[model samples]
Target: MAVSHLPRTSGRLAIIAGAGALPHHVAEAARRQGEDPFIIALSREADADWSGFDHATLAIGDFAAISKAFAAEGIDRVVLSGAVRRRPDWRDIRPTLKTLAKVPSVLRTLVSGGDDAVLRMAMDLIEASGARVIGAHEVVPGLLADIGPIGEHTSTDDDLRDIEAGIAAANALGTLDVGQGAVAIGGRVVALEGAEGTDAMLARVAELKADGRVSSRRRGVLVKLCKPQQDERADLPSIGPSTVAGAEAAGLAGIAVEAGRALVLERPAVIETANRSGLFVLGIERNARERPR
Candidate 1:
C-alpha cells in the first residue's frame, strides 16, 4: 500500500544495511541517540554482526519482500547505506501488482543509466512503496569530513594547484553523470573515476605511474566532490581508509573531499593510513575553492 505522506521521523528506523562498517555504525550511532534501528540486512552483502538488532534478510532485488518487511515491522523510514556493487539483475526482480506497475521504468533504469540515475531509480522504487529513503549521513552525523587538511602531511603550493585542477575535473565528470572523482598531477587531470569506483580508478593511476606515464616531478591528488546537480540527501561521494591505501599505491600526493558533503568512514584509520603512507588528506570548502587562494 502507498503511504499518504512520508513521516518526518520514523518511530523506529529500518536500516536497509548493505556491505561495510557503515551499516553497523549507523545502527550503533542511532541506538546511542535512543533511536534504535531495525536491521534489514541484504543477503550476502551485509555482515553477520547485526545479530542483536530487530532484523531480517532479503535480496537486493526483492522489492516486494522489502516493502512487506517494512510494513510488517511498522517501519516508517528507510535508510539506504553501503556498497551495492552490481545493479539488480532483471531476472532477479520478483514483481507484485504494485511493483509490476513500476516495471516499465524499472526495466529502463536497470539497463540504461549511470550510477546516480540508477540509484535515484532504486530509491524511487522504495519510496513508491510508502517508505522514505534518506542518506546514511542523517543517521551517522560524524561520518562527514571536516574542513581543512587532516593527517600528518600538509598541502604544499604545488599540491594546492593540483587539488584545484582535480576539483574542476571532478565537477565536469559529475555533470555528465560519469563519476565523483578525478586525479590531477601538477595542474592537469591524469585520470577520471568511473563505475569501477575510486579504488579501481586509483589502481589505473598506479598502473600509469608504473609505466612512467605520470609526471616524475610530483604525484597527483585525488579529488572527490559532490556532483554539481546531485541529490545530496540520497547520494554523496565517500572516501575511507581503503581510499587512502589506494591513493598511496597510486603514488598520489594527497586526497581531498568536499567538506560537510562527502562521507568518510573509519576516519581515525583513514588519517592513520594517510599519515603512515605520507599522503595528505583534506576536506575542501566549495565556496573557498571558487575564489583564488
Candidate 2:
C-alpha cells in the first residue's frame, strides 16, 4: 500500500477540517503538497484559524451545506479526519436524503460490529457526491507509528504475559463491539472498556488494584486495538498524552496498541510523558496468536 502517493492535487483543493487535530495536521500536509486545503470547522469542534490555512467555516450537520461549500470552493477531494462522536449524539451529521436511506443499513452494519459498514456507506455517499474520500495519512505520511514497543521500557516477561492475556480479551470483546481497550494485571483481566470508555476503565482498574481483594502482582496493563473488521479509513484507534495520564492515574505499568493500526496523537509528548511516568507504551501487531487468556 503506497500510503504517501496521494494523487497530486496540484491545482486542486480539499476540505481538511474536522473534529480533531488530525484534520488540522492534514490541512497543513495538503498545503505542503501544493494543494490549497480549505478548512471546515464543525460546530465547537475545529479551529478555523488553525495555522492560517486557506478558508474556514462551521457546519452543523448540514451535508448539503457541506457539499455546497466544497463545490463552491472547487474541492475535488475530501479528507475526513478527527473523530466525530457517533450518531444519536452526532449533532453535526445532517445526512441528505441519499445518506438517510443508508441509515438503516448503516445501523445494521454497526450492530454487526466493526467500522467497515459505516465507512463503506460513507464512502459510497462521498463518491456519489463526486468527491473522493482520501486517507488522512495520504497527506501526512509520517503519522504512522513504527512497529515494536515505543517507550522507555520494554515489556517484561510478566508484562508480556499480561499483554497476551489482554489481547485475547480485547479481540474477543471487540467482536461484540463492546470496547477496544482492556486493562490486565498479572495476566488477569482487571478491567475492560465499555460504554464508560478507556479513562473510566482505567479508573476501574485503579479501584480494583486498591481494593486489596484481587491478587494482582502489579499495577495494570492497558491494551487498545481496533476490532478485527474495523475500518482503517475511519475511526482508527487513537492514543495521546491523555492516555498516558489516564494510565498513570490508574497505576498502570504499560500501554500497548496495534502498530500501523492505531493513531498516535502528539507523539513526542505522548512518548515523553510515558517515559517520565515509567509506563511502557508499545505497539504490537494484532494476530490470532497474540490473544490473551
Candidate 3:
C-alpha cells in the first residue's frame, strides 16, 4: 500500500523506532511527504526493514547516544513509536560523559517507576536537549482510527453487549496500568490483556476457546482503548491486520477500538481482512456516562 502524504513539518524529523511496523509506517509517511525523516532504530526491537531509510541503529540503554545521533542529524523534532517491551537495565546503560550528568535521575526513574512515568521522563530528557517530541499521529494523521464500523459487518446485539463488557473490563485493568485490551464473550469478560500485550491476550483466548473455557457460540469481541490515565502520546492502543487475524483466530465476533484515540494501521488491509475472516472491526466512543468510577 502507498504511504499517505501529510503536511510537512518545519524541522527535521527523527523517528525513535522500537518494535513492529509502526516505525516503518511513520518513516514512509515522512519520506513520501518530503520530510526526509532520519530514523533512530533501536537494536533491541526495531526491524531490519528500516534499512531503506536514513537511520542509525542503537541500543535502548544508550540514551545519551540516541540524543547525539539526533543532534548529529540536525533533528529538531522527534516521534516515538512501536513497543519497547521493557526499559534497559541500569547495568546495560552506558551514558556518554556529556549524558552522564542526567544518568542518575534517569536511571532512578527506570529502576522504580510506572511505565507512563518512565516514558514521560524519557521525553523530558530529549526535549531538554532542544528537540521537540511529537506523537506518531502528528506525522501521519491517517493512521488514527476513525469512528464507527470499518467494514461491511455491523455489530450484532450480542456483540454490542460483549463490547461494552470488554470496555468496562479493559478500563478497570487500565487503571492499574495493566493493559489496554480485553476480550468479552457472551457479555462476560473472558480475558484482560496484561503485561504481554493484545496479541498475547488473544492467544490466551484461543486457548480458552479450544478448552471450552469460553463459549464459542456467538464469538467474542476484542476491545482496545486508551487508558483514561494514560499519557495518550506514548501508548495509545493500536490495531492492524495482524490484530484482525488474532481476533479471528480467537473466534472473536469483532474488534472494537476507541475512535480517534486508537491507531488503525494498514487501514484498507485491516478492513478487508476483517471482512474476509467474517469479523467486524468497529471504532467506538466509550460513553462518558459509562466510565468506571
Local accuracy of candidate 3 as per-residue lDDT tens digits, 95-125: 6655556544777777886677677777777
lDDT for model 2 comes to: 0.70
Candidate 2 structure quality by residue, lDDT tens digits, 1-293:
24566767533556535565667666776677777777667656565456586665656456667667767787777776775444322444566776667554644454453445556666666666667777666666756655676766766777887788889899998787667998888788877887666777877776776787545457668999877876566666778888889889878788888877777877888889998999988888777355322
lDDT measured at residue 16 in model 3 versus the true structure, 0 to 100 = 89
**Candidate 1: regions farther than 4 A off:** 1-10, 47-49, 99-104, 287-293
In angstroms, the error of model 1 at 70 is 0.1
TM per prediction: 0.87, 0.81, 0.91
Between candidates 1 and 3, the one scoring higher on lDDT is 3
lDDT (Cα atoms) of all candidates against the true structure? 0.80, 0.70, 0.81
Q: Pick the candidate with the highest lDDT.
A: 3
lDDT of 2 at 122: 61
- Compare candidates 2 and 3 on TM-score and give the better one: 3
How far off is model 2, as Cα RMSD?
3.9
In model 2, the Cα lDDT at residue 132 comes to 77
| Candidate 3 pairs with clashing backbones | none
